[model samples]
Target: MVNTKYARVLDHPESSIRWDQESPLTMTVETREGEIETRYGRFVGGPADGVEVVEIDTGVMRVVVLPTRGMSIWKIESKGIRFGFDSPIAGPIHPSLVPIDDPSGLGFLEGFDELVVRCGLESNGAPEHDEHGNLVYPVHGRIANLPADALSIEYDEASGRLELIGEVMEARWFAKRLRLKSRLRVRAGSYRVYLLDDVTNELSKPATMQLLYHINIGSPVLDDGAVLEAPIEELAPRDELSAGEIDEWNQFGAPQDNYVERVYFTKLCVDDSNETTTMVRSGDGSCGLAVTHNVNHLPYFILWKNTAAKSDGYVVGMEPATNFPNKRSFETEQDRLVTIEPGETKSFRLSLLPLINEQAVNKTSERIKSLSETFEATVHRQPKAGWSDMS
Candidate 1:
């Protein structure tokens, strides 16, 4: 059994330190003796102060957790493969410490370069004051920057699975009360990572809720010939820049100077499993990454592509959202906002799996192709089934 009693401050080797702090990490101090292990630590220095990182390895997959950022998975590695974008800006920056007037979303952007980043419990759009006339919500909402109030890490020896749990509360004495409880798990000798989230309303009144799984993919897995495949019923460009190159939405461009970002909103059709999937693979077809999510909870998909100068960063985001990231007011006008009544809870599930070889890539490609065809339901409607990466 794991024990928090063993937690302590851990210093980094001089050559291995990434931050300016002398000894910025504090974690549940434990020695690795098995193939599956979990560790939690924090940076005690300047920008990264109070930022906690948890590492979990299930022999086949290794994941880094950012507890300070709503338990976002910062990195995923396995079999010498890296599936996430490496942003020029590294480490976590608390949103509360950043100014809300910054239009570039710099505060949230600093940590946006991760494998997975949750968008919202209240809002995930452009900055604006709430309908109740409160101050504006920073870019992507407050959950990402709000540190988890409680955290636990455990390994199931019987199942050879590693689990990480984090609880974050977004409550002001008089405003909306909401709690986001996230549970993430990975199994031994498996190439998949699972996320199951539950968001509950603790207020006496109904509250607006919006969420998006921002899965960013870049170099290695994403290349010139890489394609974004999904059973898209229709596609619309977010702006004229995207409309200009709508024909090539599925293709990627070489990194360039002063490149403008383009976004496309796709209405997808799910398979019999009631799950929608999006994939990106290298031109060589040797490797790829596929993300599958419950379309019932997250029905919208946004493709955010930015192939700017190397220094600026290059990435493509395969985002699954409850609604498009326009202004909250705009989404309200469209009646797309998800409402959570008092004491009610909503569940969401998604899986990230690496396509290690061409066979795996081809299998995913075929599955996506089949999604466009008709298929009869064979299995019962199972909500938790989305946790399985095989989908």
Candidate 2:
């Protein structure tokens, strides 16, 4: 058996220590000569050694950015709280980490730790290209699996803010030339994680762009008695398997033997600020989590729930995207594809915060309620006969 015991301090001046069971051997130690007992810094040796990682900890939260993996946010942690999934493979594992040459879509699923960075500049669905075989986009595109060209981090002592910046290029000589410039900000003594992104078409010719923040949540934060709360205007199952239990879309079930996955497409209601939010809370009402994002850049939302057996690992995904992860060709047909003019750039912002106590959870509930009242809530009527399949 592997002994995964690890220890770390919470706040400066000797506060409490929290141990997370997500990663078996992960640990955070305070440095003697650091700014304040190791608040934030860049480090190697991610989930496993040899994998480069940059760790930034606000007294309230800790975020791990894998520079070698398209700057993916590999982990999110707080006192006795974890919001990401555990993969069988280790490290800030490289894209070629797997031995197979063509794992198809499964490649992305293998190293999908927490926040899998996505790029819509090329293709995002299964492996497929044009009839002429000129344009080739790998599964889930090539951003998350590609390494960042440049990575930097800065800490502001006066404002107690830490920012991690990463630049990733998904370009070829005669193909697309798109750049993703991402910045993540965390404030001391706060539970919020802010993300500001700017995707630019670096080429002289126009290029199609699609970006999705695939945020996955699992375990303690997502268990029985958990409920999904959002200003949802409409909900549709992805396929026949999910449509069977369409009524239970907002509730989670215990791990079962043969539990199939279900995905719900939601039309969310945005506030006057043009922002939409979603919350997932523990059944006991102890702790919870919330995600807020602007709707202008991200107009679509997807909720993926998988209640597979315990051995398989249970997880839920909250995806915000400019276009669904369908084939780029299909997205173009729907006219949902976003085109960036030569040298044109667009921005997207979002934040994730942990609801530590009842007060925090209640605040989220109240906020959702206010939004529901302020805007018109979509009334979902039962399927007239059999459920409609949209997958």
Number of backbone collisions per candidate: 1, 1
lDDT of 1: 0.73
Name the runs in model 2 displaced over 4 angstroms.
1-49, 98-103, 126-137, 374-391
Q: State the lDDT of candidate 1 residue by residue for 239-309, as single tens digits.
A: 66676787787788677789888777766778777897778888888999999898888888888888776
Name the 10 consecutive residues with the lowest summed lDDT in model 2: 9-18
Stretches of candidate 1 exceeding 4 Å from the true structure? 1-34, 44-46, 94-96, 100-106, 129-135, 374-391
Candidate 2 lDDT (Cα, 0 to 1): 0.67
- Model 2 per-residue lDDT tens digits across residues 1-391: 4332333322211212232333312333333322321222222234333444555666666676676777787767778677676433433455667321243444566666554455555665545556775445556677777777566665676766667788888888987888888888776677888888888998889888777777776677778878888888666666666667777887887777777777766668888899988988888877877889998988878777876666676777787888666666667777777888999998988988878788999999888887777566453333211222243
Candidate 1 backbone collisions, by pair: 24-44
On lDDT, the leading prediction is 1
| Native-to-model Cα distance after best TM-score fit, residue 147 in candidate 1, in Å | 0.5
